[model samples]
Target chain A: MKVTGAVKTGQRPRGIETSKDGKFVYVAVGDDDTIEIIDAATLQVAGKLPSGEDPEQFAIDSGDKYLYVANENSALLTIIDLATRQKVGQVAVGIEPEGVAISPDARIVVCTSETTSMAHFIDVEGRKVVGNLLLGARPRSAAFKADGSELWVTSEVGGGLSIVDPAARKTKQVVKFAIPGLRGEEIQPVGINLTHDGKLGFVHLGPANRVAVVDGISHEVLKYLLVGQRVWHGAFTPDEKYLLVANGASNDISVIDVAAQKVIKSIQVGEMPWGIAIAPTRDR
Target chain B: MRLGIVVLCVAVGWCGVSFGEPSQQLKIGYMWMKPSKIRVSLLDVPADNDGLAGAQLAIDDNATTGQFLNLGFDLVDREVSKGEDPTEAVKELADEGVGMIVTSLDAERLLAVASAAMAHGQLILNAVAIDERLRAEDCRGNVIHVAPSRTMLSDGLTQYLTWKNWKRWLLVVGSHDNDKLFADALRRSAAKFGAKIVDEREFKDTGGARRTDSGIVEVQRQMPLLTQGAPEHDVVVAADESEVFAGYLPFRTFVPRPVVGSAGLVPGTWNAAFDQWGAVQLQNRFVIKFHRPMSTLDMQVWTAVRMVGEASVRTGSADVAKLVDYIKSPEFSVAAFKGQKLTLRDWDMQLRQPILLFDGRNTVSVSPQHGYLHQYSSLDTLGTDRPSSKCKLN
Candidate 1:
């Protein structure tokens, strides 16, 4: 319901993720090309780890042993060894890699390139690309279902969400967004997240200023929740009771109550707040 | 690491299976006139690849989307020297099956190429020429103008000035033909927007070098004399598109009035400092790719090529007629980081976009200024409307 605290990081901070144990939060500082480590308990930046050039988005593996970062300018995935806080290796993907995601089982990593329009599949252990699935233009972010059966990637310019079958390594369905009065170009899908039960999905329509709620099974858009301007990314709280979306233009985060499916509060953040990551409460 | 190796092996095994044949190729042509002896300001010189660089970036962007739809896009760039005919280049590109050509030529040269390629049914996107006649009496059926016309620029400036309550203007125009044309547009815009041009003057070219070691001292002395004795006006409107003396009027004006037009707060397609409506991402990408800030000329060409790519993807075909039809349809719109979709006017084929009022450093405002509304789109207020269009596209 409120912004408990805020921590200053390097310029253009984008992707954020909490460690598996929920003790630390990793934020990708894009312009600085480093991931700032925050002590979740204190909400203070405690350390920094080297990432690839212009790291925009990143994902932590299931075991939290490694972090995969999508470097927008470098076109490579920088794999960081979390324990040692060092980059172990890098895998060449596509041009302007902006979105990175890991499977629920932590076996595969998906990196979506904005300029190349390709979703490259990387083997976690081999640290090399296994295969690639061509996606829509300007793909921004990706999320895996809780069960790991499907992967959803949001394409900003293409204005559609591509649902891929992880096993088949191919796109199965593309759910395009079109509002009654809004043009197709305005409905840019950027960040996507699915509920832990895989029953509900939320897609941040960049510039459209709305988050689309879709039924995970039928892929039907159930509702369009209006939010602040230029909404870029979203995250579910540890309790899964609310969704917090970062609006770049509005410089605030819209908190959506899960049960009521409406915006409950607008939490003011730093200038151009892009990505969001939620940490579990201390008791959890 | 062991699981990664096993998965990689299996993926390599699956990669051997082939898919369907590659998509059809969509070839586009970029035709432009080589840099000519145009008046250049010592302080603000033009980039050599101003229009071409933008076209190339858009081609790269289009190819990214094309790759996913089983469509391939190729750009054939042709730059002809001064006094060289561009018709040959257009014919050659048409012969090579290029259905769309983005051009950065003057009004006459563009007309020549358009006429030459008309038989081939090629669609020509005008990216540079801002001559109002091109969108008026000289409009062609196959020519879709991506650059804003002189009228549009003037209208944009007038709207902002009117909104600011600066209702009176001192209009100064250069002797060049393009300058006169722009001045005419300003006059029309003033009449339509309820502003009065208190005084109008023409500054003849008088034939002299623009940039010299000692030109600034002379300019500082002469600018005030040239602007002196004008009636009471809120702003000085300069129509010096030729870059002759307008840049000198900013700080050297007699009455300390703000200048607007080709200098001061100018209306343009894009500005490097513009970061609104998610334009920072685009500006960053352009800077990364070109290692330079994008100019207005580059943005015009980029929009043209992207329109072609959008049409190709939407129609699901590379056929020339189909692409042209789609672009002319109301459903066709291209997002050029302008916070809205830009579409072509059905009557004149001129692109409808909000003009950014930019000073050298930052965006002052975007015009169609807040209250001006049209029945169709607010953008229509910036240029010729359908009822008043002189274009008779056949």
Candidate 2:
């Protein structure tokens, strides 16, 4: 209902992820080329870790041992050791790497490249790209299923959602979106989020100004919930009651009631709000 | 005929694979007709590979996506020097099994290549020719235009001018075929947008040296005289695509009015200062790769290549027939950092996109302006609509 607080991180902050314990929020400051650590309790920048050029999106390992950042401009993945908060190693992926996702088992990490239009799979132990699966044009974000059996990647320009099989390293199904009156080009799928129970999935259609709710099992678009202009990213509240989306052009975050599947309120944020990360309450 | 045979032989040698290879490779040929010399101010010289560089970058992008799908993409760049027949370049690319070719040439040469390539059932993407007739009476089914037409550009500028309440325009046209065509587009735009052309004049290109030791003094003296004696007008619209005098009229006009069209505050597909809708990332990537800021030509060629890339990926094949069919189909669209996906117009095959009005420093506005709307799309507001199209593509 209200913006708890807002903090200025750096120019063009793109991707955000909260720590497992919800103590720190990692914000990818793209132009700054660094991951700024925001202390959840104080809502202040605690520390920063150097990343590759134009880090856009990142995901931490299930064990919370390492953090993987997708360097969009450099086309490389920078791996940071969470304990020391230092760069441990780097893996060459593809051109314009924008999305990073770690599997539930923490054995594999998927990096989606926008220009490359491929999901490069990295072996966590070896820290090397083991394989790649071609995707549609301008793949923006990737999300893993609850069981990690499948990975859903949103292609912004392709205007579709590619559901990939992790074991086979191939796309099993592609779910395309179309509105009756809107042209196909207007429905650009960008940010994606899957429910913990894997029953529902939310895909942000960038210029379409709607978030598509798909039935996870059938992969059918259940509803097109209207949001704001050029929505980019989404994060779930700690209690799983609400899904908050950062609408980049509108400069606000649209709050969706999870049970009702409708936008309840739009919380105003800073200029061009791109990414969001919700911290778990201490009571949890 | 001999050049065509030699080109065919070279093409057959390069692509040794049979027609039905399991892993299909899509080879796109970029054919450029290089002008022997261009007249421009000392600071405005163009890069040697202006359009080709953008194609190269898009090639890299295509290959990145193609590698996973077993669809390999290759770019064969051929430059036709001045005085050489551009048709030979198109024939050579066609013989080499290139079903798609991106070209950056003037209208006349582009028409020759387009007609020649169409015979072989090949598709051509016109990346930098702004001639409106190409999409109108001279339209060919084989050619798809990525560049914005003169009508589109003029209408974009006129829309912004009308929104700003600058109603009266003094039109100055250069004495060249292309210049006159552009002037016609401006005239049409002024009439459609409820603006008045108070006066019109032609600046004769008196053939002489474009550059001299004391050229500045001469240009400064002649520019004011060239623009003098016009009726009261709010702005001066110069159609000098020939680059003969429009650049000199910006600050040197007789009445101190803002100049537009071919120079100052020109309407284009892309600009270096345009950063909206995540274009800054594209600009940064282009600069990092090429070591220079992206230009309008670069953006046009990039979009052309990206169109081919999108079609190939969506169809999951490198077959030219399939790619062409997909592109012409209602489903095809490509995103070029323009806040929307650009689609091909079924009637003329011109890519429908928003035009950026740049003032040489920053983006002033984008057209398909706020108030201008169409039943189908706002993009239709800029250029020749379906009702006005004389193009009977066959």
Q: Report, for every candidate in turn, its global Cα lDDT versus the true structure.
A: 0.83, 0.85
Best by DockQ: 2
The backbone clash count of each candidate, in order, is: 0, 0
What TM-score fits each model?
0.86, 0.90
User: Could you tell me how far off, in angstroms, the CA of residue B242 lies in candidate 1 after the best superposition?
Assistant: 1.2
TM-score computed on alpha carbons, candidate 1: 0.86
Q: Per-model i-RMS in Å?
A: 5.8, 7.8
DockQ of each: 0.18, 0.40
User: Quality of candidate 2's docking, in CAPRI categories?
Assistant: acceptable
Q: Where does candidate 1 stray beyond 4 Å?
A: A116-137, A162-187, A281-284, B1-26, B37-40, B57-74, B162-167, B191-196, B212-214, B272-293, B306-335, B339-342, B366-381, B386-388
TM-score of chain B of each: 0.93, 0.91
lDDT of 2 by residue, A1-284 (tens): 78666787877787888888788888888888899998888989999987878888899875567999988777689999988998988887777788899888888889998767788888888777767877876788999997887899998878899999999998999999988767666788988988888888999998788999999999999999999888888888877789999898899899999899999999888888777777653111
C-alpha RMSD over true interface residues, model 1: 5.8
lDDT of 2 by residue, B122-184 (tens): 899999888888998999999999998889999999999999999999999999988999999
